[model samples]
Target chain A: MLYLQVLINGILLGGLYSCIAVGFSLVWGVLNIINIMHGSLIILGAYAAYFAFTLLGINPFVFVPIAGVALFVLGYALQAGVINRVMGAPVLITLTLTFGLNLILENAMIFAFKADYRKVIIDPPLGLIEIGSAFVPRDRLYAMLLALLLVGGLYAVLRTTRIGRAIVAVRMDREAAALMGVNVPRIYAITFGLGALMAGSAGSLMSVIFPISPLTSVAFLGKAFVICVLGGLGSIPGVMVGGIALGVLESFGSLWLGPDYSTTIAFVLLLALLMFRPTGIMGKRGFE
Target chain B: MTGGRLLMAVAAAAMVGALPFMADNYILRIATSMLMYATLAMSWNFIGGFAGYPSFATAAFFGLGAYAGAVLQTKGVPMIAAWIVAGMIVTVFAAAVGRAILHLRGHYFAIASLVIADVLREVINGMTNLTGGGMGLNLPVLKIDVTTQAQFFYCAMLAVALLALATSVILDRSRVGFGLRCIEQNEDAALRLGIHTSRYKTIAFSLSSVYPALAGAVYASWVSYIDPAEAFDVLFSIKPIIMALLGGAGTIVGPVVGAFIFQVMEELVWRNFLNVHLGLLGLIVVLLILFLPKGLLGIGLLSPRGRPLTAKAP
Candidate 1:
């Protein structure tokens, strides 16, 4: 029964993990650049949700799309105006640029919203649903469901839509896509927007379940990097698999090794995986 | 070398060397920390700037050195011996790990290094008997107070920084430096031209780790306390990279210049700006990234366009 509970918890946690990973992975897939400030951006989304709840009195669920859309536009402009200029520069330049952006965003958030932690007062119905011999909280179950839906929706959009094809095309061959008359820059911007939007949605969901703070992004950034590496940079479905594996590992690792090691496990796993298997699960080999 | 330039450098070093004697305790303290940071940044440039492999595990190596020193102190070793042993240990670990993980490229190597840092910290935390778990460890003073210790650490750090600069300048003109540049530009071509890319990178990686380890040892000794968080702080990893980038990576003076400028800026912000300092720092990085991707000393300022700047001392 304990094992069952662990599995269910892991699966649920994995859903949220997938949400975080997919956003980061999408950005990596499309732009060939690691968005170092991604975690900070997610925290920004969480803060947005907090404001929506406290000031505007809107439901946290209702604020998801609103925050997502706003972040999308912001990400679009960032890529279009700034990142595009140094698209093909050395990787060090990209690293320095994004790293600087991360510092700026993190510090900006800290200044704008003080270091105090905030959480949305959901006041949810504290009911538990019995599944076989295990019980699950309604809140967690809802969060898990929403995360799954978002991942599925994102996967579908990428797999089935015309814009999605363009994105995949660009990722595969930027020059070829441009030669094929695709507006590569526009597609790149949209992909970045979508990636940031997914992160915003993850943030909104996370605010309801976890305490929100500007610093929370730093922790999640570490987690997201682990997941993206595990799942492979461009492989969307691999994120789901990676997330589930990490969530389970973390849950069990925390149970056995204490919570102190729980957070670091993901990073350790990430390094091990990267050293051994940079391609990640079900992903194309090399550079991604 | 021209006597004028040599004299100028010596004078500058002497002025900085005399700072602890002349300045207030606070200035001395911050200067000590700045030198530590400068050492770290310069060390990191050995790999990230020169060899083109940005290892985010720099904090891990630093933390390892700190812990090694701290652990040796518990075994009743003197601080200086502890620091030397710590540096050796970190050097070996970096060399071994670099040999294995340095095979990866770009972001792959980056994420791997980050993982190493996190993992090392966790592993250290798990050894509760040794590391004191999350509570951290405090060292018993054999015979030292905070101020004098800070002075000692400052001088040690300054010495290490000087060594790093010397090494960088040496490598800047050596055959290995040429090979590294070739590899950075085109690994395939470099390999085709008979460059031992892996060996060169490994040397750079081990060399890069030496100063951080030394700095970490001094920092732990001066503070007389160490913790997993303080030791493995990712912020340390990021700061050096930022400093290297800000001043210009691959240049001998870049990390030093970057560290000095950024540290002073950081001190000023922390002192006067209050809560908005983080925002300001972020803005600075973003602006730098957008405007000066080649770093503080770009082609336009330092050298003619499309010309390789590769001359050593006359």
Candidate 2:
């Protein structure tokens, strides 16, 4: 029964984890920038949702798209205005640039929000549902479903839409895509914006389950790294698999090793994956 | 080295050596910090600047050194011996880890290195008996007066910085240094040229690790307290990279010059904009990378074709 419960919990958590990594994976895959500001962007989304819920009396789930759109604009502006200037520089330069952006965003949040943890508390607590000796919280279940839906929508957009094909085209070969009349810089901006949108929505969903603070951005970023490495970089389905795997593993790890060791386990797993299979479970060779 | 350059070096060393005698405690402390950062920046130059590895493991090596020194001091080891032993321990550890991860290039290598400090922090936290977990640990306080102690640490840090500078000078002239530069330019070509890329990279990585370890040890002893959080602060890994980049990476004097300039800027920004210092630092980094990729030293030192004189044409 306990094992069943843990498995369920892990799967649910994995859904959220997938949501977190999906945006990061896309930007990294397409832009070839690690987007160190990703976690902070997610936090910004969470704050947007938190403020909306508190000030506007709106549910966080309802405010998810609003947060996503807001972040999309910010991400698009950042990539277009700032990051695109260094698009031709070394990987380290871009990474450092994003790191700087993260510092600015995180510190701004800290200055504005005073570093306090904020959460959107529902007026009536959403209770839990039991299935064959395991109980799952309603909020987590909704969060998971919403995450899956968003990921599915994104996957569909990539598969069917013109812009999606352009992103894919750009990712496969930038010069070729540019030669084919695709606006490479614009695609990069759109990809970054999409990534931020996903992060913002994930942040909105995460606020329901976890406390939102600027400090947790690093942890979120770390998890995204682990998941991306685990499932493979730049692959949507791979992120899903990786997220669930990490979720399940963390669930079991925390159960056995105590909660404090969960982070250590994740990092150890990341190092091992990086060493043994830098390509990740589903990643092809060149992505590494 | 030219006689003029050697003489300038000596004069600079003498000036730094005389700082403790001439400056107040606050200025002496800042000088000590500048030296520590100089050591860190120079150390980072070996792997990051010369070898082009973009390692973020500075905090890992530093925290390991601090804890190793602190734990040994608690066990009644003499302070200097502890610092030396800690350096050796971190050097060996870095060499091993470098061998394991150096094959990864670009972002993969960066992420792998970044995670090291986090893992070390967790490990240190778990070892409650030795590291006191998250509660922090205290080193034995020196019996000397405050001023003397500050001077002692200042001189100690200056020695480490000088050692790093000397090593950088030697590396710039050595075959191994040439090999590292080749590897940085193109690893595949360097490897094909029979330059033992792995060995050179590992050597660079270990070289980068040692001075930061020594600096960490000296820092642990100076502060008289060490915590896993403070020891493994990611800023320790980041600030040195910024310093190196702010001067001019891959040059002998770049990291040291950058460290001094960055320290002064940091002190100024921290004083005036305490609340937004981090944001300001970030702004500086963004602006620096965007507008001055060649660094402050590259200003007016361009070649006829406008490339930085020190940089090889890509």
lDDT of 1 by residue, A188-284 (tens): 8898889889888889888888898887787888888888878777787888888888898998888788777787777767767877888878777
The 0-to-1 C-alpha lDDT of every candidate, in the order given, reads 0.81, 0.90
Give me the runs in candidate 2 sitting further than 4 Å from their true place.
A285-288, B1-11, B301-314
RMSD of each: 3.6, 2.3
Cα lDDT of model 1 by residue, B99-128, tens digit = 888899887888777777778887888899
Q: Which ten residues in a row have the lowest lDDT in candidate 1 chain B?
A: B305-314
Compute the lDDT of residue A79 as modeled in candidate 1: 84
User: DockQ winner among the candidates?
Assistant: 2
**lDDT score of residue A119 within candidate 2:** 88
TM-score per candidate for chain A alone: 0.95, 0.98
Write out the backbone clash pairs for model 1. Answer: A103-B282, A104-B282, A107-B278, A107-B279, A108-B279
Pairs of colliding residues, candidate 2? none
- Per-model i-RMS in Å? 6.4, 2.5
* Candidate 1: residue B162 lDDT (0-100): 82
